[model samples]
Target chain A: MDFELIAESLPRLAEGIDETLLLAGSSLVIGFVLAVPIALLNLSNNGTVRTLSSGYVYIFRSTPLLVQIFLIYYGSGQFRAELQAVGLWFLFRESWFCAILALTLNTAAYTSQIIRGGLQSVPWGQIEAARSIGMPGFMAFRRLIFPIAIRQALPAYGNEIILMVKSTSLASTITILEITAIAKKIISATYQPVEVFLIAGAIYLSLNFIVTRAIMLVEFWLTPHLRVDRRIPPVVRRTPAPVPAP
Target chain B: MELSYLGWGDAGWGDEFARGALMTFAVATCAFLLSLVFGTIFAAFKLSSNLLLRAVADVYTTILRGIPELLVIYLIFFGGGQLLQTIALGLFGYDGYIDLPVFGVGTLCIGLSAGAYSTEVIRGAVLAIPRGQIEAARAIGMNQGQRFWRILVPQSARYALPGLGNVWQFALKDTSLISIVGLVEIMRTAALGSGSTKQPFTFFITAFLIFLVLAWLSQRVFLRAEAWANRGVRSA
Candidate 1:
């Protein structure tokens, strides 16, 4: 209700943008990279590989991300000596890295399904045609299959991105000073929960809106043929239609 | 070390973990049922002839579904108690701190969010009901209530089963978020046990296994329901 209070807190909340972007960006990139192999494995010709990949997706997808975050962050700390012996403790020691790892793993599970759906939707005829022309296995996939699958997956992937952005708010619980963390801090200081959260919510909405628009643009660019037909102006086309002589 | 901590006696947290699992089941079941009621009402409103009623239902579904569940829980946890106190005072002319039980709070939070998702699922199912069937019922001169019970609700339930199952699973998984409000569900119990014993791997892995079991069993039940619902429907 206090517009002035929210107006005043904008700068402090803005400071958290870098951390928020960092959290979301790292998780999205790593999650996408991790998802590709899992997705491919899920669709593998080998039954064992397919089962293993599907099992991974099932386990990760069924559990809550909050549990995963705690398990990685605090749970990994329980194995300090062992991890230190392997020189991997440093990775888990930092809250940010742990947050990223958890989010990446979680999103990878979901994204693998999305990607697998996309990959599955590619018709067999296209692959057959490519093979008929003697397109190599890798070449055909790279040229024909991957592009089509990515286009199919883009919209779902965009939803995953927004989900991840929202998921990053969990990092605030682990002391990662993202926008939500900053909002919490501001609220504790100002004792104005509504204003702080309102401003923070606006930030999230704007960020999500921008990301959604960008993904849509990418989708548009990727499928130039799918765009609205601009071949002829309406006025020119509407002028007494020239009927073909029967 | 892990075994002792989770041992089935006073020396460990076996009882607490078991109780937490029970509480999770209790809360989820209550929330699921509540959401079903809430969903049916909202869905009926959505399908109602009144434009204003439809708009109200639409707005409820949109805001609840669009926002993250965590924010919803936070708002409820912080504001719910005060709201209850205000209501209590208005109704009974009594003013005291109204303590909402963790079960009540967690179930209500989960129910509110689940109801939003369920409203859409139920609405879609109702809309999918063939117009001819309703017309036939009308021609048969059945009362409004009878037509709804005998013809519409049953058919809609069959159609809505799969989507409602999805919403149920979503609700189950989301119950873990209620740990923040101190519901002491499986996730919270595991977190607490892991923190106390410093055996994170064991407790978390155990929690994960429990969830997998619940999810797998629920999916099987839903699949059974789906099969039963679709019985006698021929596919070419």
Candidate 2:
């Protein structure tokens, strides 16, 4: 409705994209790292190990991320003295740190489950085949199991990345100048809610589009076997030149 | 942790927290049902013969699913009222300010966003129903309505339950975003309490526990529903 307003606000909102990417990218990286061990623990043979990991995943997954964010950010204020005693007050004092920490832990809970599913879906025979080849336990797990599981997991994990990106908007609640936050600031100030949000929404859509495309590229690379070899055409048996009927 | 902060009556926030939890549940229930309506309609649109209807449905789900829930709430909160007021003023010549209630806006935004997710799930469920089943029902002289009610609904409901359960959980968690728009849901209640008490950990942890309870209870409910839907079916 306000073309001029939209043109003016574009750059202001664009500035937030860097912060958004930083928050989401960092949280996703940490979440992925944390999820691997948690996933493995969930699949562990030891009952206690499995319970503890699944409990961690369950508790995190069950609760809302906003509460988790609040618990880490403002919640730490209640324990300032204790955190100070442990010399960890500095970390707790920073809102950005808390935001990333909350997002990381939350995403890990979801990602670990995805990873667990991927790991579980790996063919049992493959592990046995690795064992038959005299592959060491860790070696087999590292090379064979991890690769196959990652490939199996990529599609689901792609959805998780989109989720994580969308979730970085939560950081705005804590004063981080992410795209959503900046958009909010602009809209509230200018009273051009439709114009401001349309731009912001477009930014998010493009971000997610890029993310999904990257995931698809990874999936394509990983699943070479699923792709047909266009370089090599399928062979068709030559038809007999002379037909007896003819 | 200060136990007195959680005490009931005028002494503490126990009553408010309970009310807040109820509010959260109420909002989630309304939003989830609203979403089912949106989902079914959009699913039908996607499945219909009209290309324009299919394109509209696709655009709805794609854009809705892509953007953050917060933005949707904000857009509805800030932009939706303005749009409605313009229409009112133009058609009815009403000049009064149309202040959209936060609860309605929040629930609508959440429902619309959740509906996009539900559309895909329901569509998938409907598509999963075997084509031959419909053909056989047709051969047996069932009308479109009969075939849809008897043959399609039951089977798709079974298929849709698990996905719908996930959507419900998503809708539940998303209610927290409504707090940003000043709705007094669980997150808002916790925030108010924490700010006043200066004991953020106690109040937020309480909020988290309440959510955990809600999620756990609903999960069991979903499992039961899934079982109910799967009646007479043999599992491998």
For every model in order, the TM-score on chain A comes to 0.92, 0.93
List candidate 2 segments past 4 Å from native: A230-246, B88-96
lDDT of each: 0.85, 0.93
Best by DockQ: 2
For candidate 1, give the docking quality class from DockQ. Answer: medium
Write model 2 residue lDDT over B7-58, tens digit each, in one string.
Answer: 8998899999999999999999999999999999999999999999999999
Give me the displacement of residue B157 in model 1, in angstroms: 3.2
Candidate 1 lDDT by residue in tens digits, A32-144: 89999999999889999999999989989877788788888888877899999999999999998899999999999999999999999999999999999999999998999
lDDT of 1 by residue, B1-236 (tens): 35778788777877888887787777878999989988999999999999999999987876665456776776676656656776889999879776678888888888998999899889999999999999999999999999989999889988999999978887888888898778888989998888777798788877777778888888899999888878868757
Mind giving the per-residue lDDT tens digits that candidate 2 earns over A1-246?
A: 999999999999999999999998999999999999999899889999999999999999989899999899999998899999999999989999999999999999999999999999999999999999999999998999999999989999999999998999988989888899999888778877999999999999999999999999999889888997669777999987886684
TM-scores of the candidates are: 0.88, 0.95
Cα deviation at A143, candidate 1, in Å, is: 2.4
